[model samples]
Target: MRGFISLLLLTLGLCLQATGMAADKSVIAVIVTNDNPNKSISLGELKLIYWRKKTYWANGQRIHPINLPPDHPLRLQFSNSILGSTPSAQNDYWNGLYFHGISPPHVLYSDEAAIRYVQETAGSIAYADACKLDNRVKPLLWLLPNGETTTNPSFVNCN
Candidate 1:
């Protein structure tokens, strides 16, 4: 009986740890500088911006899109949502566009870095784990892992 209890406790602990890790991927914030005029963005516009199809904001400032590393969970979620494809698959598209002077979003090392980049660069945008957000940037959209906006804004209480 003692051995069985110990095993159950160990399993529970591991399961909890795994769930905590996955929680970070549950919600993401599409962030931009507070000074950016746009209060909200649409899914189609996000797709165009990330794809480099939309080179400038409506205000005429050039758009600068930031990205996290290819395998990062936040980035994978953003790419799948905004680009409608996986990071690896998008590489092929970027390669073809390379000859035309188009480049993929600049890659940063972490959500913090991406946020910092967006804050410092006007007309810039990036996605980060919503829970990690700070006041330095504004969130244009709060998205689920599947790329859909959260139905209830109150449910996403980002700091």
Candidate 2:
């Protein structure tokens, strides 16, 4: 009876572990892409690019950043992670910028549209959930729940 109880407990533990792994696997990093050959982007640089603080790639090409709808989870994640600001704050910031004739980043309605825009446009950056990522675009940074970056060295090239 003791051995049977131990086995059952171990099985339950394994099941929980598997479920946790699956949950982690569901999250993914989506990125912006450019024709330039650079392989990696620093977190600071990425933030500047997304926030319209920086408008050119490392190679001096024009930068076009795409965005998700205001309410999308990944949009909120990107804003919080990269801009260190909330959506309402960002909206206010953009409004302020716009009043000065400074246009904000272009917003898209969905992740698929954002991906397509990035793929077709040169020096474009966008974000999406990892599970939905395709081979067409590369991920630049991963945003953790704590608003810290998890840099992926493999995707620096914008390939």
Count clashing residue pairs per candidate: 0, 5
After superposition, candidate 1 runs with Cα above 4 Å error? 1-24, 150-152, 157-159
Quick one: best TM-score, which candidate? Answer: 1
Weakest 10 consecutive residues of candidate 1 by summed lDDT = 150-159
Residue 87 of model 1, lDDT score: 93
Tens digits of per-residue lDDT for model 2, 1-159: 999999999999999997665444223364666454656678778778776889987678898888787766667667766777867777777887887887887889887888788888888877776656677787766665455556654432232
lDDT of 1 by residue, 39-144 (tens): 8888888888998899899999999998889888777777776677889988789999999999998999988898899989988999888888889999888887
Top model number, lDDT? 1
Cα error, candidate 2, residue 77 (Å): 1.4
